[model samples]
Target: MSRARRLTASTTAYILIPILAAVSPLLVLPAITANHGASAWASVAIGQSIGTALATVVELGWGLNGPQRVARTSEKASLRWLTLSLQTKVIALIPASAVAAVAAAFLAPSDSLTSSLVACAMTASALTATWFFLGKGTPWLILATDGLPRLVCLALSAIFLVMGAPLMTYPVLGLLLPSALAPCLALYIAAKRAPLGTKLWWRARAVISALKLQSTALFARAASAVYIALPITLVSIASPSSVAAFAAGERLMRMGLAAVAVVPNAMQAWVGAPADRQSKWSRAKRAMAANAALGFISATIFGLAAPWAVTWVFSGVVTLDPISVWLFALAIFTICTSRGTGGIGLVALTRVRAIAVSAAAGACVGIPAILLGSAWGGVPGAVAGEILAELTVLSVQVVAIRRRLAAS
Candidate 1:
């Protein structure tokens, strides 16, 4: 294929794969609740949340270290580090799966018979990690490793649901099975393309020394967590129901934002490739302005349609009041604008510390607002808190980006 066609295919695959993979799981929630009851469903959600949290920590660790390794070593050496990390993670997944199986058998309701299901879920997580590693070296590997699982899971879940299986079983089958298989499949493809070769291990002493020298990168990773993950965590704790509500709003918002992000994502890469600071600043401003316009237009649409959308999507499961709906719609707008600007600025300038600072500020504002809102206003309070936090974070990002551009 021509380079342009190849890039187009890759982008299309990335966009479509996740949507297909996510659809079955998203639609299956009502069935799961009908079969397992709310409390049981809550348990499963909590378990998944915990698993996701652990995975996030590991990802942060890897991100903090991975780029530093790339900076310190040749491209070939960096590829080796990535390959080794993928292998170690894949090997570790087996034991993790076993442990999750045992825990599900004991912790999940015995009547649910979730051990096999949980095992599959854990395996899938491991597979995803492997696929991600494969994608790092060969970007096209992303289509095979990343996109295939979604296709597989969508198929499996459809089959299971058609057979009148318990709703609880679908989560395990959908999440775990694909996750487990995607990596194995990717590895198989990878092996055929290029066999694994041994490389000298960077000793722990050297690795640790390298990490210490790149402390700013480490801090950036932590800041990223605060920026991206904190809102979801806070929502889960403050108003569990609101988490789902917010998630729905955010999902739709993200789809809209993705359309806006294409230009900015491309511009950042172009800017980063050159040493021309003036060109980078000009591109950044244009991206920010474009994002702002997109946000306003999208937010207006969301505000108008949120009530009907939420009611239809969550029909007979969760009901939303007007205030809750409004808050969620507002959040969708603020988060997209803030995150887009911040992401573009950070990438263009390579200002890791600024990214961290803005993210930290956002987390600081958002978490407390969630806590206080829940305590005082119930669901509405929770929604209000999220809006406040997001706005604060966005403000910080705007100021930081401006200062960075000025300095540049």
Candidate 2:
């Protein structure tokens, strides 16, 4: 199979997985609220947050480092870096699993004990599998390998939801089970197809060394977790209803942005090609313009239709204030614009360090804003914080690109 075909297939699968996974969760929100109440759900969300934060740190570090190494070194060296990242996840899982077990044993269980356990297990498994694929597989294969499990689980959850199963258990179990199983399967395949040749200890040390060298990425991951994940956390703190509201807005934004992501994703490969520098620049510019235009059209349409869309799609599950919905729509537009421009520039230039730095700056600006905003303004404040942070990062990225062009 051709690489382009493989990449296209993988991207499609990756996109579908999230969309499907979201379905069950989105469906069950109303039921969870009815059964467990907001506070219980909030507690569960907190536990999930811990797992998410850990996963984000590991995943983002790998993303930043892997691409940088790929740009700078041979594909073999890039594969080695990917292998090291997988090792890091496996090593981290040992500790994470221990913690999860202790939490399950000692901590007061939520409404869905089985679901929570499954969620934790799935988290670890998914992270491990994702890293493994990153190390050994082609990009498309890696994406598909990571995404397929989630998609399957999501399908199952949807079926269960229609059958009137416990809302909390079905969604969490569906999501988590696939996550756990995919990695185990991936590992088995990996072992059979391409067994590890290097000494385990040596591999571990190499990963650690890479991790140390990529401290900037580590910091970037940490900051990104705060920047992207904080809204979910804050919404939980504000109110379950708030979470539903913010989630509705964010979901719409995400769908639109996903469409816009095609350009940047394409630009990553174009930038790395051995073409004339001016050609690369022109390609990047065109991509940026196309993405920006798409973003504007999508945002405008979404903003105009948000009320009916929210009412029709999420009526029973979430009730979003018009103002809040509008803010979210606007924020989505800004984010897409920022991401489209920044993504093309960064990928084209292979500026991994700059991307990390920009993420860190955004996080620094966002976290405090979110905290203060949630304390003072609730959901509105959280939205404002996100917008401010994104703007700050976008401004920095724009300046950086301009400077690079000047130097060139």
Candidate 3:
């Protein structure tokens, strides 16, 4: 297939995975709010929030570093690498699952065991052929194995919501079903097609070493998760109403970010291709510019429509103020412009520490911002902090990329 076709297909699949997956929350959350009220909706949202954070820990940099490994590896080594990576994630999965169970115990009192299991499943979903597919430049495969199951589960969630199933059932169908299905399907596909030679125990040892190598990339990935997941956790602590309002706005913003993520998803594959340094640098610069343009357009359109969208999506159960909605738009634009181009470029270039440091700096600015903002102005303040945090990360990513280019 042509490079352009692959990029477009991959980007579309990548975009669809999240958007389709989001249908669960978009449909279920509001349904719960309309049926049971904000407290019930908050219960599901809290479970999901905690689950998402644990899921990030389970991924352990595979999503970011796995693509780079795939990009640089020979075809013969690809399956072996995939197996090895899967082993490493599985090892991490054990402890992470334990942690999730404990977290669910404290955080999700309504249905702790089920919620924890859901969280563990979502976290384990990261251990699949996704990175291998992205690395092999067959990102469309991700749509089939990863995206399809979630879409199927989304339909189930919608049906359950319409039937007025119990509140916990919404999360069970929405979060647990998809999280369990997607990764299992991806791993099955990989195992049927390509078996690695590494023994289980040996693979475990090698995974330790691999973890050391990928530590910086892992750090970067974890830091990125903070801004995305932390606010939900924080808002839950603040108030049930705040959780509903913030989650409503945050989910919409995430959908927009997913749309523009096609740029970076393509950039990673494009930049990872074997090429001269100068040419790669040129492509990176162009990709960044293109991403920025897309971000601007996405931000403008989404910002304009957000007020109406928020009302409709939440069924008028919860409505964010204008400032919160616009700040969400700004956050969407910031992520769209920076994440796909600048952020992925750093990973492709193996500037893992640079990316990690930059993301850490943003978190340092963001966590406090979120706490203070939520305390002061609730949803709007939290979003204001989000805007500043993303902008901070973006600024650092640009400077780091520039310095890396000049030095090279």
What lDDT, from 0 to 1, does candidate 3 have? 0.71
Stretches of candidate 3 off by over 4 Å are: 1-24, 108-118, 191-202, 239-241
Residue-level lDDT tens digits of model 3 in 1-408? 898886687667777755665554565555766776655555555656666776676677777767757776765467667666767777777887777667765765365655565566556666656667877777777787766766666567667767877655655666567666655676566555554552223455777788787687778878877777767777666543477788778877876676566667666767677656666666667777888888888888888988898787777877878787778878877887777544567765667788788779888998888878887888998888888888988889888877887887
Q: What is the lDDT of candidate 1?
A: 0.54
The candidate with the higher TM-score, 1 or 2, is 2
Model 3 CA lDDT for position 102? 74
lDDT of 2 by residue, 145-223 (tens): 5555555565666566556665455436665666656655554455444444622234556777866776766676667
Q: What is the TM-score of each predicted model, taking all chains together?
A: 0.72, 0.76, 0.89
Q: What is the lDDT of residue 193 in candidate 3?
A: 55
lDDT of 1 by residue, 1-408 (tens): 899887786566545543444354455555554554545454454444334433433333344334323333444555455555455555445555555455444444333345345433633363353323322333345546655655566567646765677655566666766665665665455444443563435455655554454466535544544434344445556666555555444444444454444443333333343447667657766777776766777677777776776555444454567777667667767865765576555655666667667666767776688777865776678778767877887887778777876775
Candidate 3 to truth, TM: 0.89
lDDT of each: 0.54, 0.58, 0.71
TM-score of candidate 2 on Cα atoms, chains taken together = 0.76
Candidate number with the higher lDDT (2 or 3): 3
Which residue ranges in model 1 land beyond 4 Å of their true spot? 14-18, 21-24, 61-78, 84-140, 161-168, 182-271, 275-282
Give the Cα error of residue 92 in candidate 2, in Å: 3.8
> Which pairs of residues collide in candidate 3?
264-340
Using TM-score as the measure, the top candidate is 3
